[model samples]
Target: MKTDDLISMLAAGNPAPPRAPSARRFALALFCGLLGALLLMACLFGVRKDLAEVAATPLFWAKVALPAALVLGALWASGRLARPGVAVGARWAAIGVPVALVWGASLVLLAALPAGDRLAQVLGTTWRTCPLNIALLSVPAFIAVLWAIRGLAPTRLRLAGAAGGLLAGALATLVYCLHCPEMAVPFWGVWYVLGMALPTFAGWLLGPRWLRW
Candidate 1:
């Protein structure tokens, strides 16, 4: 066959390789997160016997719910971005960076208010507590998710990394809320933002190269 004719025949006959395994990737992410949570709990339990008391509070439930919801949303968003021929960079930045910044800011603000103030009262006494909590719990989960999705052959690794970081931050915040009592808004606005946002950004920047399978 002529070379051009042969090329055309092959192109017509063959299909593209399937992208990375989505289901397996998601499963791995979830598993890694859960493992991290368990490890966090174990470590915390050893350090602070009273950690159970914090876990029993309604705030803890709120923490878990919010982050879980965010994770689900992120998974959906990530899947959409993963589609072929999309401008992954633009889509990821448009969605991921702002969401992460706003989310981190809000959490910090919520943490900083005095416990008796309506918002603060609702959230708890120690705003910084949440970031610490999240750093311990959700960071692992985020790492897991990144690891699972690392095989995708996308050019925008930085964007993917940032998205992954945001997902991790959300999950960590959720777990953090379980143990935190809430605090002044200002306290949270600064400290919490630094704690959560910095790590997330770092993760996003590093994910593409480091997390790749």
Candidate 2:
């Protein structure tokens, strides 16, 4: 057979791969992870007693918004990374911008506060518990998201793992807002990032071992 004709014949023999499998798996993972995080939060901490009042406050939304933005970026990066040779590209920016904004807000607030009060704001009342709670809450998401990633083909296991971990961490953080009373930007900038970091680091460490397929 002629080279071009042979190539055409081989191409015609294989159907194009389906496009939506990645989307479906990720969507399902997001739903399940979020539900699990919510349940864990409710069972473990209970919703903060003043949720109704707090929900009306802008700071509450700001807390929710920060992680929500990371979730979007991480989800995108994870989905793309699940497929071999896909570049993460602007998705890195998506995850980074929210964190940058939160930190910037925190610095501004710190600058405006009295020096003595600055320590209290950064520490908050629950600095010790906040990140710990976030990391604890990330357990369900960590499992669900990594499972989702493993089901697909990921060439860069560590990055894909980190992305999956971040997605879970962000989802957990979003749910955590319901129970976390610390509304200070400095608190979120410090503890919230640390909380999410635990899972992300774990995923990066485990991706090669866990995600090999």
Candidate 3:
């Protein structure tokens, strides 16, 4: 067929109405998943007793802010990944910036504390179960995020998966802060981040299988 005739034929047919962009759909799905996770947190582990008074404190807000920042960065990276052939570019760097700042602050806090008490500060009382709890809390969000990206095109599957996991884990950590009593930056730098990393690791391992188009 002639090129002009083929072009004319292609333009003649009506295309289906355009639906919402993948990123918007993903955001909505993630929001629902987060709500479910929050409900799970409330049912399984209620908020801390002194939360009302402590909510205004720097320590309490610090816990929320770090994870909140990570959530924003991950969401941005994930949104880009949802679109085929789109480079995430500087978005990954944005994710690392919050993490680096939080860790740097943690080191400074540790330095300022008495040398003898540094270990206790890092280990905290809940060291053993803290990361596990965060990982468990992330399950709902992770599943929801994975579902959101299932049909979307992500050329970098592993990176996309990691971003999804990070998003889930960060959201879970935010919910976890309601029940967590630890107020130390060192604890958050080590354990809370480790909790988030577990899901990121899982996503790296599972992304190829689940995200394959």
Q: Pick the candidate with the highest lDDT.
A: 2
- Model 2 scores a TM of 0.91
Q: TM-scores of the models, in the given order?
A: 0.60, 0.91, 0.88
Weakest ten-residue segment in model 1 by summed lDDT: 80-89
Error of 3 at 118 (Å): 0.2
TM-score of 1: 0.60
How does each model score on lDDT? 0.56, 0.86, 0.82
Model 3 per-residue lDDT tens digits across residues 1-213: 133543454476522111365656677767876897788889988889999999989878988998899998988887777555567897688789978988899899889989999999999999999999899889989998877765565557888888888989999998899999899888999999999999999988888887776
Report the lDDT of model 2 for residue 2.
31
- Give the per-residue lDDT of model 1 (tens digit) for 1-213: 134543454577632114456566767787777667766856683234455776676644544454566566666555444332344444444444544654675666556756566454334455536566656666687778676556443345666666666667666655554444443334444444444565568767786676543
75-174 per-residue lDDT for model 2 (tens digits): 9889888765568886699989999999999999999989999998888899888888998899888888888788666779999999999999999999
- Among these predictions, the greatest TM-score belongs to 2
Which residue segments of model 3 deviate by more than 4 Å?
1-19
- What is model 1's C-alpha RMSD? 7.2
Candidate 2 lDDT: 0.86
